[model samples]
Target chain A: MTITTGYIISALLLFGIGMNGLMTCSHQLRKILAVNLMASGVFLILIVTGFGTDGSAIDHVPHAMVLTGIVISVSTTALALTLACRIQQRLNRSADETAEGNDDD
Target chain B: MNGGLTGMKKRKQSMKGKFKRKDWQFATLTSLLIATLVTFLCWAILKEPPGEDLTAEALAPLFVQSGVTSPVTAILLNFRGYDTLLEVMVLFLAGLGIWSQATVDPTNPLVFSSPATHPTKPNFHGPGPELILATLVRILIPLMVLVAGYLTWAGGFQAGGAFQGGALLGGAGILLILAEPQRISTIPPALIRFGIVLGPAIFLLVGVSCFGYGGNFLQYPQPGAGSWLLLIEFGAAISIGITLTTLFVGGRPDPKRLKGTDQP
Candidate 1:
């Protein structure tokens, strides 16, 4: 197969793996990682779309779009992680309070 | 009583077995679905005919007018600047969301404030940073800053740009925070807030200023586009760096802790 097709196939595999992880994993951090993997697969597809089969010039627009995508993904990841940590903290606190009440009983 | 206890234990074992079986079935089904979807996508891509890229060709002739030699930079800062503008705002909003969700104690920036009697702490509790790591961080931080500056400047002509420089700066800031959390607290919170706002505010200002020159928003006049792009890049790099660092810190800095009123 051509190199472009190879890349496309791998990108699809990556997306599939990410999707599987997102569906199966119970951990919040793992879910975040899965989403990031999916984003990377999409980015690979975008970059490959701009790849020239012949001696044509590569598209700069896709590269710029990828850069923007990377930045957005980073920010979103940060926000998601912060939210996850907050949720975990709340859960831990409530668990501790419940345990304390049980001990008193 | 013994028979009842044994029956309860058997029931629990059966329940566990059922749950495990359900989990396996769910995983298999999901995997099958994902594999099918991916196969279809790949087939579609392989079958599609190659199309001509009109945008790249259109971008070629306008490179000089966009004021930067690097086509990517030109596209990012001049041609499709609105996307970058919104991107910066998105980053700003993310930082705002993080800050609103939790507060980090200034003295121990690693510890976030929660309503719980015992606040959740990260696993890496220690007396202080190790001597080797502290030294390494001290050595690397200055070099990182220098490289970040170079990247931002080089973006006008080559591959480097504000995002890369800002990410590097953010890495440096993370190292600094990790090595000396207390040192971060000593810096005024107001300054941090200013740094976070600097990039988007300047970007918006530059975009709005285009109207004064008798052009639409973000429409740079042909003559002075390079300097304007550079100005925006510098501001964006600083803001991105600070915002990223704050995000790593994981919450807003507590003003009370900064004032030394709260020792915890």
Candidate 2:
């Protein structure tokens, strides 16, 4: 297979791995990581598509789009991580309260 | 009581085993489904015919008019300015959302804690930041700032831009926070708020002002396009840097800490 096709296949594999992780992992942090992996795969595919076969000039449009995508992904990941931390903190607080009640009983 | 505790431990072990088995099966099924979907996607990609290169051809002719020598920068800040404008807003919104959802966890050792307040808290990470790390941060932060500025300027003609520069600045800010979290609080909250809002505000202003220049929204007049792009990039890089650092800080600043009334 050509090098370009090889990259495309690898990118697909990455996406598949991420999807499997997202579906199977119970941890919120792991799920967020999986989503990031999926995004990376998508970005790779866009870059490869922009890189035309043999004698063609590199496409700048996809490069710009990828840059934009990267920024958006960072924002989303930060927000998700914050939400996850909040959830964990709340869970821990409730667990502590339950343990205190058990002790009192 | 000992016997009861042992019985409870055995029950928990058995329950964990059952859950593990279930999880293994679920993982296997999900992987299989994902594999099949990926294989189909790969087949489709391979079979698809290559399309004509319309964008590159169109972009080539208008590259000069877009103001920046770098095609990517020109496209980002000029041609597709709306995407960037909305993107900055999204980043700002995320910062806002995070601020609203939670406050900085005081228990986190990464945050500044006075010896008097957290005397009982074990130093799990280390004996705290070493002199070597402090010196390294001191040396590197200024350099990072300089490089970030260079990258922003270089974006007009080369492979560097506001995003890269902003990221670098963000890294420097994170390093500063890690080294001395207390130092971050010394900066006025209002200034931090301004820094976070600067990018989107400037971008919106520029787009609106384009109407006076006899062009559509975000359309720079042909003669002064480069300067407008530079201005936008400068504002965007600073805002992006502050926004990223704020995101890492993980919550809104405490008013008491900002006012310097709270000891530690």
lDDT of 2 by residue, B42-103 (tens): 99999984688988887798998988899999989999999989988988998888777655
Query: Of the candidates shown, which would achieve the greatest lDDT relative to the real structure?
Result: 1
Candidate 2 chain B lowest-lDDT run of ten: B112-121
Clashing pairs in 1: none
Identify the CAPRI category of the predicted complex in candidate 1.
medium
lDDT tens digits, residues B52-143, model 1? 77877877899989999998999898888999999999999889999988888777788777433334456556788889988999899999
Q: What stretches of model 2 exceed 4 Å from their correct place?
A: A99-105, B1-22, B105-129, B257-264
* Overall local distance difference test of candidate 1: 0.89
Q: How much TM-score does chain B earn in each model?
A: 0.90, 0.84
Colliding residue pairs in candidate 2: none
Each model's TM-score? Answer: 0.92, 0.88
Q: Give the lDDT of residue B142 in candidate 2.
A: 99
Evaluate model 1: give its TM-score. 0.92
